[model samples]
Target: MLMKPLIIGQLKARLPIIQGGMGVGISRCNLAGAVALEGGIGVISTAQIGYDEEEFSRNPIEANLRAIKKHLQRAKEIAKGGIVGVNIMVATKQYAEYVKAAVEAKADVIISGAGLPINLPELVKGSVSKIAPIVSSLKATSIILKMWDRKYNTTADFLVIEGPLAGGHLGFHEDELVDIDMDAYQEEIKKIISLKKEYEEKYNQEIPVIVAGGIFDKEDVKRALLNGADGIQVGTRFVTTKECDASDAYKQAYINCKKEDIRIIKSPVGMPGRAIWNPFLEKLTKGRSEIKHCFGCLEHCNPKEVPYCITKALTNAVEGKLEEGLIFCGDNADRLKEITTVKQVMEELTV
Candidate 1:
């Protein structure tokens, strides 16, 4: 099956591909804009977005808000009218502030996850920016749909189903990740699709289901379409693209990884994350480290209690210190071989 345009609310992408938002300078204006220019939905991750700003360490919220507008403007400049969206996690400390900033900048869309985005509709109410919530199971989809129907009188513009093999923080528990049952998960995706239909009809609108996590090539795209997905969101594959915003060392980490190098570990934000087993993680396995600085990024992050600062570790990775940083990747990172361009990656995945 050939890839087709994905229609999400008022926006449409020539290719039904969304570049999943990888944070800490991974997928920023350069990467997102390049993909958008290629007729796909480009996504910028809002997790510690202002890491490069001079004042970011001193004033995180202010720097991030400023960086949001800066990055969006830069992406729009490169997109040349193509669709460019922002991926803002609901677990972010200043969630409403970030959402409002994206909407204020007139971002094409906001794909939120890391938690249920029950209040997303309300945040982008008067703006033209569309809203999408990422879910890991049928239960989460139902809850968001039900809550939106009852309280917001609206449904998601689209929904992203991130399977267990996704990068960064996963939505699944430790046990589920230990031994994933693909058949059971596929059944869950079908169930979520069924629920999407009910809400689509109830609200008299289309709620497209976009499959994410572990999506790499054309075959994966075909499988998602066959499983009832309107489109697919891809993250890890983009890490190797020349247009990706991360440093050379950061991209090299993904290239150097093997299947055994990938490990499921705990993130300071209280979620299980998949990353390459590095010296930092090896050290973490031995004992907890003292928090050097807290960016006050996540809502539940405790400065005194958490082992280490996620923002710091990720920022280190972005700066090319692989051994001391957290290297996040999808389960299929080991499957990648060489560095490629964004255009090449999109073409390979577009059937």
Candidate 2:
């Protein structure tokens, strides 16, 4: 099948693909720009984006806020006018401030998830930046649409269905992930597409639905489009790309792992996440993972009680300290064979 153009709000991409945002210095300017330059929408993850800043340890919030615009600008520059966006998780603290910062920076789009993002439309009010809410089920979709329509008089510019196989913080509970696969989600996608038709007619606008999590290679893309999705969001497959901001050691982790290495663990951010099993996760099982200092990244995190500092673990992985930090990844991470370029990955998927 030929690849279709992905239109979110007024933005258009020649390819029906959005590279899923990987946080903690994973998908930043380099990767996002490269993908966008390739005709797919490129996305930068704003989670702990300032980990490399000089003053990040002292005041992470301010550091992160300062970095948001910086990264977006750099990514846009690299895109050379392609569609570039940022992924801001609703679970992040100072969520409103982050949204405002992205809008102020003239981001092409802002994709939010890890929570309902009920107030996303309100936050992006009057801005040209398109908004996409990430959801795993119809229930969450209904809540976001109802709240946004009733309160803000707007609907999502696009929707991302992050299935059970997604990495990092998942929308579904741990129990729900048990024995579920992509086939189980086809009917739900049909329902969501059906539900979205109402708002499309009411608002008289098209709201593209993108599928994320477990999407890899050309076959997956064909399957998603055939299943009624407008596009697909892929993360794990991009980890080993040269353009990805992750360190070489971090990228190697994706290539070295086997299927059994992948596991879902209870993340400190009050959600379940998929990650590669490593010494770091094993340490968590044997004893308490250290929380040296709070980054104040999440809205509800208590430094005293969180299993570990997510910021630190991710930072460690990004900096090549694989054994010292968590390696958050999708289930397909094990399938990675060698490091490649962003252009090559895009070609393989779209072809």
The number of clashing residue pairs in each candidate reads: 0, 0
For each candidate, what TM-score against the reference? 0.99, 0.98
Question: In terms of TM-score, how similar is model 1 to the real structure?
Answer: 0.99
Q: Give the poorly placed runs of model 2, Cα more than 4 Å off.
A: none
TM-score of 2: 0.98
Candidate 1 residue spans exceeding 4 A from truth: none
**Error in Å for residue 7 of model 1:** 0.7
Worst 10 residues of 1 by lDDT: 1-10
Error of 1 at 107 (Å): 0.8
Best-performing candidate as measured by lDDT? 1
- Candidate 2 lDDT score at position 28: 92
Candidates' C-alpha lDDT: 0.92, 0.90
